[model samples]
Target: MPVPNRPVRGVAAGVPFLAVPPTRRLDQPAPVVVAWHPMDPPRTEAAFAAALPLDGLEAWRIYLGLPLCGSRSPAGGDEELMRLGYEDAVMNLQGPIAVQGAEEFPAALGALRGQLDLGDGPLALVGGSMGSAVVLLVLTEADRADDIAAAVLVSPMAQLRPAVDATGRRYGMTYPWGPASLAVARRLDFVARVDEIVRHGQPAVRLIVGARDDPDGFLAPGQRLVAGLADRYDDPARADLVVVADMAHALAEEPGVEPAPQTAPAAAVDRHAVHWLRRHLGGTAAPGLGAAGEEP
Candidate 1:
């Protein structure tokens, strides 16, 4: 499939452009991983690292770097995003930067569906931070939202107001910006949205949150996601949560900064998530580890 520079613009004038990677020829229906990278410039690396080791996926991968991070080429190659000015400030602040991306999801998803021929097989979503928020919105708002088989959310932010408040507490400064428009979050009904997806009969979701990830407002949402999905599944295979102690939401550590013990769980979290996806998406068995990476 050929990918042109053509972009799909929706109600929001500017957001992160969506990138659909090239597909490989397969004898069977190709599985799809539609991923949303964390909100920031260079969106590819951070979210990619966080969701690594997708053990059994032999399918096309579609990556969405939230508004301002730039995009990648479709040949499964990386292209440097132009030095857009707003990337820096938006990354540093917790505000409505990614709101456009969430709002524009229908267009993005449509473009991807057409490009990848998503009707071929199962679809899975992986998101981090702002990306996670967008995934939640898409799962609730898009008509095909319930069609997603499984989801893995890393440091998802359900409420930006609370996140900004948490950031102020951490840095001892006052920042009033919230994630999305307050009206939007309320209109969507964050918790209820998650429940709606479950009620529509989607499979389980994997949630990875940093126990020490204070600024992101991820802990609360991670808890709420589990609680919301509790009654939906008898086996409850869809509500998996892993709290990495002392870990923060940052995907990559700064040079010379020693990694915390809790940070090790990042890879473990990815493995657990992939294993679950494989099982649900019809992989042979759990990939090299059990769910949650628990020891037998």
Candidate 2:
């Protein structure tokens, strides 16, 4: 079955989302896979949905807009975001986004489930870059942490301090890593909180990174996260890392606030994500699935 020409779009509990229904099992309640877009390219919910639709996966693929992003951007838009980043990247931008995104998700999720008539069973999660930090926060701190069945993180910000450092280097500005920012970094460091992530359900986790992404910011922390999870998981294979060749940090072009064509790297990441969700969510992949240009 082909995906709808336009996905079901709505705002639930103050969170905007794009929902792609399963090709199979329309009448029955389907498992949900909620995803958060990165602060980088393919940043908005619609853009992220276009980038990684998880084509042919038999589940509800819900792309959620992060707080202060997409339709929820402040009055000054990207300019405001940049201003916040300059003011205090951690306290003003990253910290609030991560904390608010995680805090607001449960209500949004409940509203979505009620509105869509989705299954009450554990759902899967997917996130990219800074959005991946939101996923980690949910896994570690959300009351519904135990309700997550699986997760896939792409070019993830597993550790916030390195990402902040990388940003500082990119713009040739030294970040003032004060006590407040350092505390925020410590809270957002997923690799340091692996035990909390698996304390309840031990959800299957797969971290996918681009081979060309910054090793210090993304690759190294992802590797460390997998290693830490491996030590805790009953089956070490439940925690895995995949490095995609010829790929980089961002999945789409600059000014990624709108939906755009999916890139090859994004497609590759989607393939891995779909396969993982299928295995863990008890769904089968459709024939010829996981190909670029295919719809959800």
Q: What are the lDDT figures for the candidates, one per model?
A: 0.57, 0.87
- Candidate 2 lDDT at 157 equals 87
How many angstroms is residue 49 displaced in model 1 relative to the true structure, after the best TM-score fit? 5.6
Q: Over the stretch 1-296, how does candidate 2's per-residue lDDT look in tens digits?
A: 33453479999999999998877644445678999999999989999998998987878899999999989999999889999889998999899999998999999999988777776645999999878988999999998698899999998889999988877877898899999999999999988999999796899999999998889888999999999999999989889999999998999888787788888898899888888888887755555665433323
Backbone-clash count (model 2): 0
What TM-score, computed on C-alpha atoms, does each candidate reach? 0.70, 0.93
Report the Cα lDDT for residue 5, model 1. Answer: 30
- Worst lDDT 10-window in candidate 1: 254-263
Candidate 1 at 237: error in angstroms? 3.0
Candidate 1 per-residue lDDT, tens place, 1-296, comes to 43333323222133233333323345556667767766432145333533453544554556555654434223322322223212322343233445555677667666666654555677788777777777777776667776788888877666655654565576686644345445554643456566667755566687788777873466776677677777566667567787766667765443211222223656665666666666666662323435433321
Query: In candidate 1, which residue pairs get closer than 3 Å at backbone N, Cα or C atoms, i.e. clash?
Result: 16-67, 204-238, 205-238
